[model samples]
Target: MLPRLRHAAVVAALVCALCCAPAGATYSIVACDAAGDCGAAVATHNLAVGASVIYAQAKVGAVATQFETNPQYGPKGLALLARGVAPADALQRLLEEDGGFDGGDIGERQVGLVDARGRAATHTGAAAQASAWAGARSGEGFAVQGNGLASAEVLEAMAEAYRGGRGDLSERLMAALRAGQRAGGQRIGAMSAALRVATVAGGFQDIDLRVDAAADPVADLARLDDQFHAHQAMLGAERAARSGDAAAARAQRNEALRLSHQWDRIWRRAARLAMQLGEDERALEYLGVFASANPVWAREEVDDALYARLRQRPQFVRLREGLGAQEPGG
Candidate 1:
């Protein structure tokens, strides 16, 4: 668990109260991993919660806009964090631009921010406090906030879960969302959830997901998270292979293959990459798997120019002859 740390007065006040958000970001957290990953996770009773509440850049920071949300805070805050502004200072500057620091546009908005260095700041506006419950808590690397929730315990549980979490930054954020749900989420019952984590700060998000309309957004999001990791491992395998890290490529490839059997396209993609890596045998193995599960798709893949090298192989000939293939190792 990450250690608790004292925060600036901005976080001292749940410091923001911007404008009314069209849809809610009922409870959320923004954080930075010691590994230079930064992200935001949010669950709300709103469609496409991800489109509204969370923003992150790899080595920069993450921002969560809550209550009467202010959309600009995300990009603007990140820009500030990226420019070397501390989280507290960044939040203040955002507020200043939105209106005036004393109160400005701080209607019912709330915000949580964490810079790449683990510095945190969070603030909930007075307007937001009028809701059933609204507040925020911050520590060394995270901030959790909630409004119109069952109680303050929601954010507290999020903070606890984040601190106790392990593994990748995305996984930890998901754990926190689950914990918040367990503790009693939104007053109206959460209808949506989102999780985003960047492995390269401003680069493509390593894990970006949303459950806009589900009976249980948290559970749905969990399933997506698991599948996303499998895809991520597959990409990792390709990267390792391309970089000439044969051992790493093999290990990640095996993991991807193990985790991706249920995903119809993963095997074909894996096979294509394997062929490019000069692993003819491995390519044959994965293509066999894809063909067994999706014969129609396999036919297209086998004919693709990427597999031209494997065209004359006896095994390839056999596979093409029997598109109705059986599972590999059979």
Candidate 2:
């Protein structure tokens, strides 16, 4: 009779623990675009969720590891995808190899993946059910996963947003995150968020942004994304100009000009593009803006070949002279 009583107590304790486990987990999406770039976005009740939950490699793949997060799955999963393993097969191997993962173990993990070719996969372990809500959804070029959410609807909202959203890979990820938040995000509310897009063309450039702690992390992340928005337009302008799509170039240039004002570094890019496009007056104006924002750039401009055409211009000569005058009592 005592043995039966002890068993009942043990079972009760297990049930209580499962229902009341820590709820500070994450919701995330991983995706790859037609350009073969990979990226991830994540938000959570915990601090700096992006620091550990997201992983990606340019033209390789992306991974979102949350719940009982095992960061190793990120790089390893990326390597598997790079080797041409399907997303589902890569996840299976990750679980098989994690047999010795002492912390949290496989059952406590939830992950999503996407390769450069748009193949996708996801997993929600049994232990993930201990959280308030946990699940994953996968589609053509993206996978969405979440845990400790207010409701299962968060996962569905993310998947729907990704499928229906427009813009680049990063924008789609952001759209999905916003949708999840509207559907009911992390059960206790989000403390942090992050977004990362791996570079295409041999990993030359990437977009990595984060909102470490905030009253409204997703909103803050969106604010931060504005900087990259301008940067993307700047790159688009350069590409369009190079390809001789003058109308496209003008529109992209206007976008970069309109949005990049708050981000001083983009002035240099605008100047470079203007110079390449033979808009010398605009180039000189942008260069002046760049120099004003970053004083050190004043001296560098005098020697840069990109500005050679303007070197002999009176305005530039005075600008160079001003640098020397500002130096000592010249």
Candidate 3:
């Protein structure tokens, strides 16, 4: 009898434990490192319902966010709540309580968060506007945003992206947010322009880039796409240069340099590396670009050995003579 009672007690305890657990509050956070060329950006969009989807690009430091609400919270409020707050506590405090949102149209909306821990959370609020909003935690170190999203759904997507295949946190989060947007965004079809939130290590870029509020949101977002591609070009150039493949080295270096003349430094580095690998022709091409971009620097770095190698080629000799004749003081 004692054993039977103990077993029954255990069963009851297990049931109680399961019941006591909080119903899976939908929320998530992501760990982001902006070690890439463009640094990082947090882009969010509005979705249907009183929910907002959120994502961010973290570069150099850890970032995290917790979403909670007795009711739903918009992306903006969730972002505010996520600042420097623990995931579980932040969600509980934000959601379990009442009276968080006041007179705002998005008072009762769901919210999601991303932070350094790479965990996420969600809270569904009462009925409210299917609006979108965003925020950066502080010091341009982080950013948060969302629009017309289901709190739980948004958080789920965020977790999926954070845990999904690696490469480009900002791109992953943006893709996730876009997925959420497709399901149902902001109860409207691109009523206003979209925004872009980015974090850079030493660049002048800011936390947000918003469109004119009247243009096509998708088109607006696409306009900023060039910067990301430029970044990819930079990475590809560095990789190809390292591999000592003359064709790839020349192609990537030239492409990168064409995209951003500031990348002349990268081209020069690639040129020198190409020379070391016996790809003198490719190196010379790169040197030409470098010389054209920064003549003074080129003159100082040109080596007699390099000149001798180039002189062996009639075309190179003619090119050298032409360059010398075209110089300002020559």
The model with the greatest lDDT is: 2
User: What TM-scores do the predictions have?
Assistant: 0.72, 0.72, 0.42
Residue-wise C-alpha lDDT for candidate 2, range 16-104, written one tens digit per residue: 46665556468999998888878999998888887888998877889998887888899899999999999888988887676536456
Superposed Cα deviation of residue 253, candidate 2 (Å): 3.1
Better of 2 and 3 by lDDT: 2
> In the order shown, what is each candidate's alpha-carbon RMSD?
7.1, 6.5, 13.2
**1 against 2, candidate with superior lDDT:** 2
Give lDDT tens digits, candidate 1, residues 1-330. 011212422342354334443333399989998878888889988777888779988888999987767888888999999899999888877765764333344645688899989999886766666577778899988999888888888988999999999878988998999999998898887788999988863434477888989889998888788777778788898899889897898788777777664676778778877887788998898888888888888866777778777777999989988975343333
For all candidates in order, the CA lDDT equals 0.80, 0.80, 0.42
Ranking by TM-score: 2, 1, 3
Which has the higher TM-score value, candidate number 2 or candidate number 3?
2
Candidate 3 on 81-168: residue-level lDDT in tens?
3465654355455443435444321133344443444344433332221223221121121223343434434534544544452545
**What are the runs in model 1 whose C-alpha is more than 4 Å off?**
1-25, 99-105, 201-207, 238-250, 257-261, 269-295, 299-330
Regions more than 4 Å wrong, model 2 = 1-19, 99-102, 202-204, 235-250, 267-330
Local lDDT at 188 for model 1: 83
Q: Give the candidates in order of lDDT, highest first.
A: 2, 1, 3
